[model samples]
Target: MTSGTSPQANAAAIVGAARRAASEGAAMLFTPEMCGLLDRDRGRATANIVAEADNPVLAAARDVARELGLWIDLGSLAILRDDGKWANRGFVIDAGGEIAARYDKIHMFDVDLATGETWRESAAYTPGDHVVTVETPLGRLGLAICYDVRFPALFEELGRLRCDAMRIPAAFTVPTGKAHWHLMQRTRAVEASAWVISAAQGGRHEDGRETYGHSTVIDPWGDVVLDMGEGSGLGFAMIDPARTAEVRAQLPSLANKREIPRSAS
Candidate 1:
């Protein structure tokens, strides 16, 4: 979604997307990261973004999930923290509108780009320390945010845990997204031998931030199932467990993996 600045506007967008998903018989609907507000305006973000307890956008999304009878993966919401930091958090909402699983993003995107694109997420957000995987109707879904996609070990461990799919919610900058987004997604899917669902924020946001908008889903075979091109929209893909099984059987990379002990050398 084009999250812009208003939480209400974002919530309204989710409702509309949910309706469309329901009509098209999509059992699940996923939103992008920081679904509430994507403001680089520090003061505006501080004033608008509230704690999860006080976030109406989240509450409204829950209501929409229940109302539409759709399992909703709320990609992530950047909420205010007591330490005056941001909590980039994710949630899997059941069809009943109840939160089934919650995950805080572990990897922080603190970078200094030569293109004058600097982001100091750790300055404004407290990073999560643990990996999170949860059971879902589709399969065991591992949760991660944008920057977390770069960590191969995370996907390796999730494969060890037998996670069937990985959910990534991101708001990627255009330059980096064009360069690395699809590559990372395809690579991760092949590495983990798991389905990958990457919901992304596309186009320009209200805070003058331009995000790479191709939200994509990859099967265990590393085939792109759905790619919502550079735009503000949503799409559906059929996820099959048997396909994952078939790919694993043909490749068997996960089963063949042997970790070497460093100190033994």
Candidate 2:
């Protein structure tokens, strides 16, 4: 859905997306990273962000989920932590408005691009140590956020958990999005032998930042089933549960894995 700097505007976008999903008979509403707010200005971001206890976005999501009976993957929000940093967190809400799981982004997107772009996500967000997985009518969902996608071992660990789907919600940079976004999703889906649902932030933001927006959905066969281009919109695709088993049987990489101990020097 559309993500600007305004929380109200972003909430409006969420409503629009939910309406679209409801009209289309979609079972879930997956949103982008910082779907509530994406601001570069520290003062404005800090002012707009709130603790989860007082977050209107989360409350609205619960109400919408209850009303529409739609599961929501509220990507990541810049939540104010007690340490003066915001937690890059993702939440999965069930159709009944109950939270199924929450995951703080483990891998921070701290980097300096060759094109002069730079970010220090770790400076403002604490990393998570636990891998979160939860079950719903959909399947076992292994939750993760933006920068975590760069680490293949995370997906492999999820594979070990027998997760039927993996969620990698992101606000990726333009360069990285163009270079590795699609390939990353495909590779993960194939390697994990599971569905990968990625909802991404697209276009220029209210804060003058551009994100590589191509919200992608993939199948176990390593095929991109849906790729919503660089725009502010929603796309839906059905996940065939049986396909996961079929793919695993076909490849059986997860089964073939053997742990190698450290060599004694």
Which candidate wins on lDDT?
A: 1
Query: In candidate 2, how many Å is residue 158 off?
Result: 0.7
Q: Over 4 Å off in model 1, which ranges?
A: 82-84, 263-265
Give the runs in model 2 whose Cα sits over 4 Å from its true position. 82-84
RMSD of each: 1.3, 1.2
Q: CA lDDT, every prediction?
A: 0.90, 0.87
Per-residue lDDT for 1-265 in model 1, tens only? 8788888888889888999999999989989988878888877788787887888788988898899899999999988777867789998999999999888899999988768999988877888888889888788999999999999888888989888999999999888898999999999999999999999999877788899999999999899999999878878899999999999999999999999778964
Q: What are the models' TM-scores? A: 0.96, 0.96
In angstroms, give how far residue 237 of model 1 lies from its true place.
0.7
